[model samples]
Target: MEFIDLLLLFVTLFLAIIWFKYWSVTGGGQKNLPPGPPGWPIVGNLIQVVLQRRNFMYVVRDLRTKYGPIFTMQMGQRTLIIVTSSDLIHEALVQKGPIFASRPADSPTRLLFSVGKCAINSAEYGPLWRTLRRNFVTELINPARIRQCSWIREWAMDIHLKRLEKGALETGSVEVMSNCRLTICSVLICVCFGARISEARIKEIEAVLKDVMLMTAPKLPDFLPIFTPLFRKQLKEAKELRRKQMQCLVPLVRSRRVFVQGGRCEESNIGGDMEMVSPIGAAYIDSLFGLEPAGRGRLGEEELVTLCSEVINAGTDTSATTVEWALLHLVLDQNIQQKLYEEIVNSVGKKGSITEENVESMKYLGAVVKETFRRHPPSHFVLSHAATKETELGGYTIPAHANVEFYTAWLTEDPSLWKDPGEFWPERFLEGDGVGVDVTGAKGVKMMPFGVGRRICPAMTLGTLHVYLLLAKMVQAFKWVPIKDSPPDPTETFAFTVVMKTPLRAVILPR
Candidate 1:
């Protein structure tokens, strides 16, 4: 080889190396960032994540342990921040709530919730998301509204008890996870769409949602921007999903509840709370369908349509998973289960039924729920947040648009926060006057089940009540035990909402 050719080859290799480094640190200086496991050039964590054959939660948690609570993972050239620290988490998420509230475009929910219409989670931080979030809490999941839906608890519990009774008679075993999913989904479906979903129908939705969820599932797509066009797998799935979703959800959306006044039935209350309303009002849709001018916050008609599906997904998914996990723990741990059961029986037994108003007095029941949330958070990691401008956290510089992710699962189990973090004992929460832990150990940076600050999940209360009431009723009606040798393994499932690795199978022994 000629000397000139050798020199050219060296130059070419050097330029490629420099370009790669430049790509990784484009938005921020990438200096003094927290550490992460070294990865193959350009690909970083993506290969590890995909290769694990799907242990995303454990892999991420393991990384956090090696790299501390606040660390970074590189996907190709894109920088992904993984926060495990409560302190910096507060600084970034809670303290800087508004700035960090925005969720970047990703697969799945972009189609499911955003419907290509930017709803709360999909809509970037702006006036439109603000209006929508406000409307959701004020109208749908408000304290009074949740209270009014007390019948949901009775009806759903009734259906579930009947299911378990029949199942035990036939096989002496039942899958509690399926029951939990149906109960939680039915409650949300009833509350949001004002409809009761039978178990078979719920299974049908779950199957379709499973496909749509995979197609739309979030990964480090930001790493491969050029591949975005190809990644429309979910986008296409979203369109098909929107059709299936409409077949079920739309009819629920359209049918108006006949108002009974003085024993007379008439046109339903459309604008009032009595009518079934979309998260976004019907007037907004009429205007959009009519091709009226674009409304506030630079939003268009397409985004307007997406809001309904977003409500269904957001209102349903994590909450159902959460309810499932909590009941699993309560049932598998007979001691804890009976302790809570006793508390419920003592408080509401003579009342012949449970009521939302009386639930506040059942402090131990509340603690069991809190402990369940702490041990098994719905999302091990939260939606990625981008710094709007240069900010400092943990004595490190987080430059503008640098993607930051928070890991709540580790934070919840961190040694600094709790005693016996690994154990499923609910009594940890039962400390301090028996009301359990009121500190909310993972709210920001520490533990964020429903997320934090301004963009905190509006459905937090609704979800909490839904979970507690279901568990409360399940306990009140029957005694739960594992199905013979079944181990309700705490090992995790990789999905949109982290689920039990094994669907909990148990026997429902009636009290």
Candidate 2:
């Protein structure tokens, strides 16, 4: 019976391929489409994705050799336009604007993860996105607001240092990624909810976020919607995870409500006061309460929970992963690390505690951060953007609703853009076109780790500051020496972000 089932599957797939070949040759809609590898019917590029067993960007990179920089691939019924050229990416994302600003329709997996397209990260580009993002900027990530939250950053940094010191004393080494995550989570939670949550509650929120990230990772069923029933258990888990996120988050919002109203409430079981967090004026949630999303009325509890979750999840993982990569790179090159440390020392002195303000003076550290971003962007591409209307990109027509992606990894490494693209040289950022490259791609895209145009990461400034501070402080606080007989290995893996496959284990002795 099993053999018969396998044979039937192969037969169906063979027939699908034959049908696809015939259809492509005869299909009227094929005209003006970007050239790409011919795909099987129904399954489309699903088989190729499965066989590649590598980052999707690399597969697109290989396709570019035969199909040029801008090509298309079909994933199940979905058409994906892959843009590898910086100029083309700018034309689509920046020049075209709203035509390419909207997100792809929620696949089953994205719906499960986002809890129905409420989060800023996944919300369709429009009035609601604009309102939420505007509030996010004005209340949270704006320069003035970030500076106002300096106390939260400082508070988290103190805890981070003590935690690392404890680990160094007790275990002689620490898993740096976990520590980085905790520090980032602490800051974000305070920023989102306007309170310092106890370590125990922070742990609970972190666990759920991690689980949801793991579960929502692109699954085969996500591409082949017809097979979604096979992933019923995963989908169920997503629902439960969303519920858990709401349970953990909503109460904090309520508690903040109580405090904002000047009415006393029972102390949280999590055991931290809003005062303990030093209340950075208005929280992200507080701003949401004041927003009137057009046609949607006031933001509700569910949207608030999801948006705040976006705050924690977005702020925590990507910043943590980047710092981890930054540290990994620093560990691999002692000279580079020392150079960064010396710059910090010259700017703030070895004994002086580095503040958020001090990061600007550390030029070499800034370069290191940019170099790290280029070497290991949090993800290869931004969340897939959808074409809202038919458009021409690089002289090829992108039909309305076609999913579009810009491969940042490929463009960042293109030989024409950078000399010796494979080398990890921060010096490149200090000279020539690499010097002071606007990551926003406002002046032409050299490296778009955060993306470009209206959909560019609003958290870019905040995330960059978090990374620069954490990295500089770590270097200032201790000498991150590799575990004896175990030098750091710079390997790559994809998870919530691009991570070191072999996690860095290192000891930190006071500098």
Candidate 3:
């Protein structure tokens, strides 16, 4: 078997070599196309990219500076198009959004079985994606639906409020960032899974899922299809991650969907009572379960289950990371905290009491959150998307299956659009400081915290409200202090989302 595998690998490599030579010779016609760092022969830059957390952002930025706005490199046989400048990013992602809106059809995707049912994250630009996107937009992330679930936001905030009081009285110090992340994780999990989940359970789940995610980091085998014979363990580990993920994810999804459509997500005194049900709308689980058997299209049971898991992983981590960053900023700038507290007090009173009715009244808190999101995007880039067809973009053809990435963090901080882009100033968004947030899609392409175009995040509004209301509640109730003489370190370590090299350690003091 080993001999046969090695023989097959060499045969595949021969074909790949011929195909790559053709591509390189044919691609040489692009006179105006951007340049990039010199890559090794055959190997290209596959090793650097597959190293997982190699800060593709900084590398791409450096390439843009050295080369031009748009650049290209080869990660194994996979052709990577990196757009660093905001102009190029906008031209590719927004102006030509329709063309660059799909995800690559690749071997790793097939191996992982993520072809369909992943919704907005990995869904192809088609009807099912459109329907699912619409369903989420109209029912789940809608303004009215978000308003209706104001209680859930409040409940999540109240947990932190209680913690703030305890932290203020006990230590005059707290890991506010950790607590914020935990609360957001809990809320988004409850919202997505339609089950009652605790912070302990989230941490437990994160512990295991963290290990599972480690195995699926973009492998060299993922790019160099011919080399996969030597990396069979990677293939097996990817499947195992999916299997383990399903072990935890599927049953919860099944149970919660049953509860949601049956209206059991809101039952009372059901804390530890496994027999009881709690109502929380037709949460994401119900949506997946409902779509599972309707096999009018390509989605199968396994694919549905996989997408259900994607729902949890995507919604939970990003929101939690954003909340962490927001709290970190709040702790770093006490004057901002004081201003936010005053706004919350003036709007919702001194207890930090907020309601569905009062949410819109806290305008300053909203601006502050919009600014925070501008500063720290949850993910360095939006999920990679692929163009479905050969299409023109930025005066060049984006060939079919070419992966496109949008750097929301970079776009939000672009100096051309933002005055003092690197500076953390909530006032930039206040009224007349040459900065204004166009969340309603009313202005130029300035900042896209929720992303822009068709694949924009559905829960952007609710997520924003959650960040504002929760942070306001915390700031109103407590004064925050970093553990050291200075503030939380701004240096970040990359994860699926950016994490502080040192988590913000602080003591919470009473107002």
Index of the highest-TM-score prediction: 2
For each predicted model, how many residue pairs clash, with residues at least 3 apart or on different chains?
8, 0, 11
Clashing pairs in 2: none
Provide the TM-score for each candidate, comma-separated: 0.82, 0.91, 0.86
Following a full C-alpha superposition, what root-mean-square deviation does model 2 have from the true structure? 3.7
lDDT of prediction 1: 0.64
Model 2 spans > 4 angstroms off: 1-29, 263-276
Q: How many clashes show up in model 1?
A: 8
**TM-score, predicted candidate 1 vs. hidden true structure:** 0.82
Model 1 is weakest, by summed lDDT over 10 consecutive residues, at 256-265
TM-score of 2: 0.91
Off by over 4 Å in 1: 1-25, 28-32, 39-41, 107-113, 196-202, 220-222, 229-238, 256-305, 432-446
Residue lDDT tens for model 1, 133-180: 766666666666665667766777788878878888898878766676
Positional deviation of residue 121's Cα in model 1 after best superposition, in angstroms: 1.8
lDDT of 3 by residue, 169-256 (tens): 6765676556665677666666666555656666666655555445544656666676778877767767776676667655665565
